[model samples]
Target: MFTSGTRQLLAKSNKLCLKSGSYLKTFSAKFTTCDLYALVEPTEPKVVTENSPGPNSLKIQAEISNFQDIRPMIFSTGIPFSSSFISSLPFCENSFSQISSIPLGYNHHAILDVCSSPEMVLSLANRPSLTLLPPTNWADKLQNIHMKVAPKGLTNVFNTVDGSSANDLAFKAAFIAYKEMRGLPDELSEQELSTSMDNASPGSPDLSILSFRNGFHGRTMSTLSATRTKPIHKVGIPAFKWPAVDFPQLRYPLEKFEKENAAEEKRCLDQVEHIIKTSKTPIAGLIVEPIPSEGGDLHASNQFFQKLRKITKDNGVVMIVDEVQTGVGATGKFWAHEYWELDTPPEIVTFSKKMQAAGFYHQAQLRPKIPMRQFNTWMGDPSRTLIAGAIISEIESQSLVEKTKATGDYLMSHLKPISIRYNKLVQNVRGKGTLVAFDCPTPEYRDMFVSLMRSEGVLIYACGNRSVRFRPALIFSKSHVNVFLPRFESVLNKMYKQLWS
Candidate 1:
């Protein structure tokens, strides 16, 4: 099934793998390697076509574009056929795992086992409306799967569709809780009942969720209103006139700029407090991402987050930590907010991505006393919940969280030196665990950097403005890192020569 050129590439790759055979054997046993990895034991990425988005990829994209937008798609991914011509098809050696959603990497045995189970099959075939007709073992699944890693101080779970809907539910719960906190009657007044239908005040009310600028919660109507990253996600859509506060832009080599970074954080916190106290629309909820994943992978000190928790608590606002992108061991801790070491946890913790299932954990007080307040046809997918169970089990059994922390330290140790060497091209190296990123000289440079990484078969992604973020799966080991770094430096070297040499 291989052409002469492909055979030659494979032959060269085989020669390169001899020295790393011991490491490859051990690593492959720990996790299910992808098809591409199975073909080549080392970290080499192969592109058989003359240029990427090969004819097959382009043809598939053209067919897909007939019915949907293909602008965001990078390439078509599928199992290569046994045909001789299939050698031209490309495969990603190490993906960020579908935007960092894949926890254990592709075709993980645990996940596959769960998916192939009778429970998963039954759930998929006979889906449940969990709020109304939940499965008999639903509570067991929740306790085992979701609650197993529930953030500290949160006792209740509200399963929803995804990060957006999770935040949406959290918003509604906050609004309801806000009214309750005000000692309003449980029953809606006749005026409120009538006004809600027309989408006006008193029922729909002049309430809002305050979000930090550049923090992304989700793309649903209410969550999108709070999303302040890119204009494209918000333009042409009507949004709530909600309040936003500045997120601190801390400088790198943190110790070098402690005073300035602290001052910047204080300024942002002061703004947050001011908006909370003085906004015309009562802020019922305040949503934030621990790492601000899509917002350039921005981070604040633990003290900054601890202060945020205290501020929201003092102001009686429901603090929702959007862990959609940073949760499930990506950031060393299962929940990134755990790094904050808060005396009291945030009121609502929203999560998705790696968890397979999506939802928010909250204090019981945040639960609407009335039923159907957060209802949906499929409250949450049971099959996905099953997958989440498998993921949680694997994370615990493998000690992936602790390992990820070590791996992150390893990555940073290499990255910091690289950043200094290529200071002109790479800047602001910051991350928690495997969730790492660095800024390029410009947005154009960042885009080119991503494209270059793709050409090398290391599929990465860009975030913020000029930032290149790495959201590798939890299973990303030191072996993978060893493979990734040489290529990473190669890309940097190429970019450096282009711009600076």
Candidate 2:
């Protein structure tokens, strides 16, 4: 039930387009707001250019290459607009390409309304140094927004710049807490104070965070050490000697291979416990993604995660579940770790991506005793936090999390049959909620699949060696799934015919 003011606010921005073919038709309607996106989004994707880059995109790439690296640039979108499609020309995208960062779809009316508010203006204009001078409502905002969805058993939030910084700070907090647990004096000793400036141990200790193989945290100095997805991300970068453990590699269909998958998970869990017990450098914290997004969208059973949590607890290693990609509502549960149902929750859970704000939630114990250790300039942007608040509100009001679960189930029902039909091309279909993925026969095929999907105007992307990951926004509904499946099968059919030829 929208209030009069809320109705007025939505009505002001309700004059959106219903794109048909290449033409966008204007319609003015009073929406119930339950399915606000269908009114705002294009009916279907439209690709004007024969090639993905086309002429306009290539020209922009050439211009950008003069001062920036455009090697990573696939194509340029046209005029920015609301809905998943950022542009009105060249093509419209059902975006998952930006690494699942677009939370409530692009330029959603709710977000737009937030942007136009006095609160947003003040946040942008002031941009205060939060550590020294946080807004008066700072505490209230955090409690109302972040705490509203804080993972069960976690009560504190530490805001940072992005996922990488969030993990980095979490690591620091773990280290500080680790030393404090050893009954070290709160105040630094003379030797500890002097050695710190020289970047030596005792102060700048050789402590490390344990991360899994193919797990990616971030690219910051400390986080780069913990990331293990690709050598390309770590090559030539100096890294700490952090121990890397094997994440469970389960076979799919998970039901058919239950016994073997159980054995594999047990093997990995054994290795994790072994490493934590015997690492030469003290493993102060262990970080893991509930689903390793960049690492082929891998998954382990709830039992496996529970055992892993128990291992971390028994071994006295701080458990930091890195939910940078899997957090928010994408994974059915608002926090994916909720699936584990750990007897004692993980000490720290870091987040970014869809949440729109970057930070970690932890038990109060992880807060460093000494001040200025985990400090940063602009500790976090209030504007982004405000946006995050709006995102949460929209997610709650529309029951997007539950909807995502239903959509994911809908998507899987289609993908599983397609995988069987194209067994040579598609394998290992797996996902939770809308964060789904499938593996191609090879890296080349996966890349080709992504390229063709983009040409078909669905901007999907790949991960790991040969997996195509689908990262749809929370508003992705059954109608969107219907649009996606035919295009998906068309590409598969085309690829399969070509393979035989």
Candidate 3:
């Protein structure tokens, strides 16, 4: 039941700017928030009516449906969203990770200040197609930001629109490098040129990317071929016959299943070897997520990842760590794969999400002999990168990575007991930093629990099938967690009565 007042506020919320002030001292003030960087105008959620996505949202859903598939409308929407939380009626702290974006949280003054800048507005007005004609400030911006935060070994960057495009371009780079390794001729033959037009053999080589089972790369043709999460995302679309191997499904409280998990990982590794040797189309690249998120926040031991690095190195296959979800301080470390401690770095690392900019990082060797083999009109957006630079500055100045790790330890310690008390409801409580997740007894239970948590004023999300994931922004603090945990317990208490009282 949105009032005319609430509706007007929601419509213009994006333009609501606030002057920066000292951090509010609330909830014990465990860790402090900077005056310039903290979230503002925080409010608690209010569920004014029964049923999530009440009449106002439903009416909006119908209106949007007249234009296109209204799937986004079907969601129990959090209408007025902010950096830390969203409010339909009940304002709840965000934990969806914004699908793992929103690095600083909704409207941090630093970012808003950047967004309101004359320079940022100019770029937004006349965006450049980066690959063809880069802005003069492009090199400076990359120097100050992207390169400043380049993954350990990778030197080059290719900015794109989103995680999917970042990965798609990364795959293209992999195939090009694969072709180079095979010593393919640069000049096209008459037959090769003609065959390409027909989408046949020599023209478009039968190169494939070897991915892991339950891994999700993207939804585009090449990536969707690698994606193996849900059948629905792939049911109607035709996919390439790319080969996939199993991602190790390790049992939790990892120490308990050490031997069995090692054996499981070894079995998976052996399959990778066999698949590479026997696949009909030669595998040009092997792409894997450090944590197979969306496939249910599945995790493997660091040793398992190291072994994977070894296997890809032994084979000619290019190793691509799809850091789209796990990068930028979410996983405690700056990069989740940093935990792997492999002898050699992966050839490519694709990133987006919290970084605000989307692209892959790779060594000089992966650069193609020629350009245009992988490009688009808007190679990337400069305005987004400007936001990214501010995020990087905040990350560095605030040391948010270290803060995230400490906060995660505190959270998991508290959550462990809840997992024990509510064993049937919350099991396998696992995480690295705040990229935490747990499983419900069933998908229906997970959905119900999420709605209940919202009523208690803590916004969370579900992934894989029965798992609920916590992806709070880097700015998430001890205060936020303290606020969150009690609400979580209250929901658990209410749920216990409803389900088992």
TM-score of each: 0.90, 0.91, 0.89
Please, what are the lDDT tens digits per residue for candidate 2 over residues 371-404? 7878988988999999999999999999999999
lDDT tens per residue, model 3, 1-501: 346565455434422421122222221143222322222335445556576566876877788789877875434454343322223222254576457788877656568668767889898999998878889989999889899988888898888889998889898898888856556666667887889899997888898999998899888877898999999989989888888899988887788998999999999999999998888999889999999899989998888889888878877788999999999998889899999998888999999999999999998888887768778999879999899898989898999999999889989999999999988789899999999999999998899899888666566988898999998888887877887888888888888889998
Q: Which pairs clash in the backbone of model 3? A: 45-90, 45-91, 46-89, 46-90, 83-105, 83-106, 97-100
Candidate RMSDs in order: 6.1, 4.8, 6.1
lDDT of 2: 0.83
The 10 consecutive residues of candidate 3 with the worst lDDT sum are 19-28
Alpha-carbon error at 401 in model 3, in Å? Answer: 1.0
Query: Cα deviation of 427 in candidate 2 (Å)?
Result: 0.8
Candidate 2 wrong stretches, greater than 4 Å: 1-40, 79-92, 95-97, 181-187
Model 3: per-residue Cα lDDT at residue 27:
12
The Cα local distance difference test for each model comes to 0.83, 0.83, 0.81
Q: For candidate 1, give the lDDT of residue 289.
A: 92
lDDT of 1 by residue, 260-285 (tens): 99999999999999999999999999
Give RMSD (Å) of candidate 3 vs. truth.
Answer: 6.1
